[model samples]
Target chain A: MIRRPGDAQFTAFVQDAWRPLYRSAYLLLGEHGAAEDLAQAALTKTYAAWGRVREPDAAYGYARTVLLNEARSLFRRTSWRRELPSDDLPEQTHEPDPSDRPAVLDALRLLPPRQRAVIVLRFYEDLDVERTADTLGCSPGTVKSQTSAALSKLRRLLGDAVLPEGALHD
Target chain B: MTERLSALLHDEALDVPVPAAPAEAIIAGGRRTRVRRRLGAGAVSAAAAAAVAAVCLMPSDGSGLRLAPDPAAASPLDPAGWAVSAGSTLYLGNGATAQLPDKVKSIYYTSAGTVVRTGTVAYTDAPDSAYALVGDDGRVHSLGLALGDRAPSTDPRLPYLAYAQRRGNTGHDAWDVVLRDVRSGDVAVSVPVDGSFTWGGWNAPPVALDGDHVYVGLDDATLDVDWRTGAVSTASHLPAARFPESTSGRVALENRSGQPVRVAEVSTGASVAELSPGGGPGEGPAAVSISPDGRFALLVPWRTCDDDNACVYDQPASEVLQLDGGRSATVDLGDQVGWTPDGRLIRVTGQGVDLCSPVTAVCDPTGIRLGEGPVKVGGNSYES
Candidate 1:
């Protein structure tokens, strides 16, 4: 368990929130080192506002929001670049058989930060367009447009065999 | 797609190892980030910055921006050293020597001096600092307040600095814009404001010291705060735009529209000085502010992913618009230091501080260079 700094409840909170937030950060950033950094940074930001966070359960969401915003800022700045999508497949790994599962990660890396974020929130987080819009600070129109564009890119990268074109509209 | 994605994510989440929770670290980092954000005046305004953000992120080769390691050698800090950040080591300008505190979080270069924020092991951490202003004369005066490191902008001609401060972390989160007389080392006046914009490419500090009066922008409104008296009044009739980074609140710049068109006078919506920006739909311009001399407008056009059909994410470009309404010039900037006192556009690239004069559109061949390799961070100016 992560030892809480000043409060007793925070240790349990961090224990519960760690994996999920790390997972989201991993998906959003598409790399291990950056993902860990992003998750930890988000957690730190949430910790700074622990008093203001209000509800104990909402800490994860707040941390996730900070992570996304920080990721957005990092990407928005020129120092870091998000990986673009590729038509080429990855080099063979030592593992046995491979499905297109690995391609999803690669394909996700290809999407721009904002579009990738929209997909993660809308699909992975199971958020509605309105909620996604609120998270991204864009209108529902932008959310819809980004989702459509991101889906279209994913479809192209993954192909109709794995991701049927008609099915992505949902 | 959603079901498969969910399942795939579940497996992926399980695949990654859960490291021991670093709760103490998180708390420390959080506090530092809060200080940086609050000090930046940009942390609280993510939603606001997003609301007014343009979709332009130019394509870059990522050739120069060094987020990695550069060699350590004993080299005199030059004028270029004033603007670069390599790890925790700040390249003190003009071959000067001063010990930067342990766990420095944010570094703000003001006209009066350079302010260093010290703190711990957070993603970014600092010493418990109100903030320390190291004057050009080599005196470091501790303000003992949580003023954003780079939030204060000083006038080159005068000894006045304008900045903003938020109340305590919780409860009533009231924000105040303040003016400090650098000569007297006193806060001349403090005006209450509704909101503050964060630090990034798109926003500038709203509080500016122009002559005797200070101009500031609140969310959707602009106000002129008197320096002599704490009297604050609305610069009524200015367009509903953010002047987060303008020297004169009398005029504001924003990019909700197509290109980054300048709102001539905030009080009157007569827009002028529209530059021919090289961008598509969401690739409009933002992060716009005027040079200290008022001769040029600096804009960093945002590159949006909305237009990426291939999901091709790339990095690149900075633009300068002539305030006289002439053509704009594009510079290949990797990292930006604020404008020099003489108004030379200084950019730290793979090379060093290339001081480019806007009039000639020519950069000095020889400029200050941070030691070779990747510069960890720092080169952000408070003027921004």
Candidate 2:
């Protein structure tokens, strides 16, 4: 486990976590420019309030919380739309697996802010309900309900698509 | 199918790109913020120092630096030789892009008959269009169109406006909104609504038109209509007991019942999960506006200090509440009301006219003026 991060410690911490943090922001924001901006903003805010943080090991979690809040704030400040290229690209050029369905992301984008956050933390981050609730600053019951509601909506929107067998358990 | 969907979501999640230069950008932003804070501190210190010097330099006879008072600083209400409204008068500048001056207020043609302005400008941009009302002079104007293209047709009533028409004869003809070329009498674009299935009654006029969408207020339903396709979607709706007053897709609805108003996005229809301004009942919502970009929702809450009700009618204390996603901030406008075209600053009226730039929530009483009529501070007066 990492020790508590001070101002000096933050520089190293940021350097280490920057990549994954950026990836998480990109997924939440959809636009590369905004994702970059959001990630940097979260990190900067974390640095500014570092002295107030009680636990050094929890800095990463605190930064993630800031990122989530910022992502939600950005969504509110603008009508965010992910630019989906309409052209059919060759399989080799596609970043994700060619067989991966894009409709799921589309449906996910349609969900409201809170539900979207819950899903991102629960599924993508592989966090348990209590942990997800802790990160979101909400009760575990709220997290459970939001996750259930979001999954139900996703199911309705995606129709025949279902979660992979071990995906939820993870 | 659920498994497939989850897999796809996971794949997309993994493919999201990381930003390359985050630290540099944050550092730059921090530098700028630090500079601004220092500048503000300097200004405050300078003012304090000046006040002390004034006291120290005063002669026993009481005459100190009494040369001719600078005329520029004497009259606080003097106009700064610039147009003083919430929006800008020019298109290329940093403020709200100016709308064409000669055109009528807020009249427009779409699938839903002619849309008229209610005289309020929203703070956020609509998801689809730039909605405005035709002015009282009966001239039709749009925000981004060139003056030559905006000339009203000879028919007057049936101006050659641009609109999106419905294809074939779908029973959902009600959803067919269009953008008309008022001068040429030609249909510019016809958008087809593919799968939208719900329709809320019209509450207000369509305010702005973007390339494919028309921003309209259907009775209590605030929505965006695809001008090319007749796709209809709800953006926000009016709270109960609140009838809409002047509106740009963002509206000012009055809660006559003195109850706190709650609005929700139509997609989550009739669910508490989607409701906003979830305050206790009885706290009425004052006139409110949304930014043109649909990013921020501004709520003005009014406090009537008198039981006569007449006192509360015109001089209620007004507070502006800006809601951005889960975060919210309260801005004190004193008297200013309307927002600029870009939604960056609000035009406020009070002791002297001023602009409250929301990015900072600071009021600059530099170059603003109050016009005639019951001067609504944040309301839009551009529409006919």
Candidate 3:
């Protein structure tokens, strides 16, 4: 294949953005194969829009936004296999261990796609309400409501161990 | 609480083995996109560049239209013969499918042909969107236009595609609502709308195209823009509406309280018909789509998923409301996106296409397989 002038720089960007993008995709989509596909699709799209990306340093942010958008689209597709939420919540009467990965991931899979995205963006990505809303293409009020709803649901499911009292106050 | 949740999330994300970055594949995809963009470098490319430049150098006089040949008279096909795009293929009413150069994001019907928006993926909001006009003969003509986030609006009776483009920075109160003739690939009209408009969730102002008028959604009010003469006025009839969905000269209005209470005439604030009030709190029905003649409205009731299991059923008992007599029929709206010009409800799914009637609430299966993937009907809001 013939190489373009910006191929090397874009290759470097893909290498740098791959891991974080994959992790974020994994958090949004609980499956490994789907997460890998989402991350790669996002990076490929970022490359397509590379000409518009004025600042090279901002490439990662652009890729992240693209990944979130792709995740949103995937959630909307009817063909996508949705993880059905069970009526039962795992009993958690004690302070939950932070390293308890299954409980958190399962709880996440239980939340609606939007609420899950809000949790991932707010807690994992550490984005504020406004930035999260901007990235998710929603209103701040929507972000806040979804965040509150998600936290309340998570608290009920995981109990005070993982999300303690006054957690919803945040 | 934030810290604990954050820690738990980090712990969950940690140790997930990431595969090697496919840099070569990504670069190759990007290269293919660039080449596809330059498909017709002579006329179409020049026209696209001119349109971009005209937008960049928006005239202060509110007259940015670059003159081109008069568009051919609109000759829309039978409303029964509609088209839909699944993946990269466009399934026409005649049972012939045309493969698009890229993944079809959304399709819009014009008298000229089915206007197709193709992108890297089927996401309506994806970047680097390219527009093409697909004829009945299955010939594809690239419009060479890449409208970033602005949704394209079209009236089946008209040959132009309209959208609102904000001028300058966020603080700027000025916007140029452009109408591009799909046939000639020229800016037929561009008028400036001055206001500190807030376009709620949309990257740019949302617009709805009627015969000669374009209703532009702004923060405080909807502007009635006469594209032919560049006359701008407030469509007080619509009030402060966003995502103004319209066809057959009627605009569907959503209640500020989140319910769709009525459908109104665009010209006059006259009530076309009063929509049935949705269910009680949290169960309100959403006005999803309107029939082409504005005589029928599709209302899908909101379903509450279990808080613990967040599982939403695939299909809901959607209803089609006759605006004339208040008669309603139950139909599945999960896959129904738009209406045929003759007023039949168009439902597209991975299985096939189904055309339903609003009056009888009965769907006639087309048995036309769209193959596999997401399907976007031509008259949907994503393509307007």
lDDT at B84 for candidate 3? Answer: 78
The digit string of per-residue lDDT tens for model 3 on A17-55 reads 999999998887666766776787788768767765777
Best by TM-score: 3
- For lDDT, candidate 2 versus 3, the one ahead is 3
lDDT of 3 at B278: 33
For model 2, the stretches where C-alpha displacement exceeds 4 angstroms are: A1-7, A81-170, B1-25, B37-384
Predictions' DockQ, in order: 0.12, 0.11, 0.18
Q: What is the lDDT of residue B120 in candidate 3?
A: 75
Best by DockQ: 3
Q: Provide the global lDDT of candidate 3 against the true structure.
A: 0.65
Q: Write the per-residue lDDT of candidate 3 for residues B337-376, one digit (tens) a residue.
A: 5677667877764466888888886888887877765567
Q: What are the RMSD figures for all models against the true structure? A: 21.2, 22.2, 19.5
Candidate achieving the largest lDDT: 3
Model 3 residue runs over 4 Å out of place are A1-170, B1-77, B122-125, B167-171, B201-203, B281-284, B303-316, B332-337
lDDT of 2 by residue, B1-384 (tens): 234544566777666555454455454444443353334211100000000000011112212111112101111111111123222222111222234332223323322123232222221111222433333333344434322201121111223243322345654233334444433334444333332221111111323453333444332343455433354554444321111222222332222222223333333223111112312211223334554333354554332221121112112233333444344444554543555433544544442555565545666664434333233332232221
TM-scores across all candidates?
0.47, 0.36, 0.57
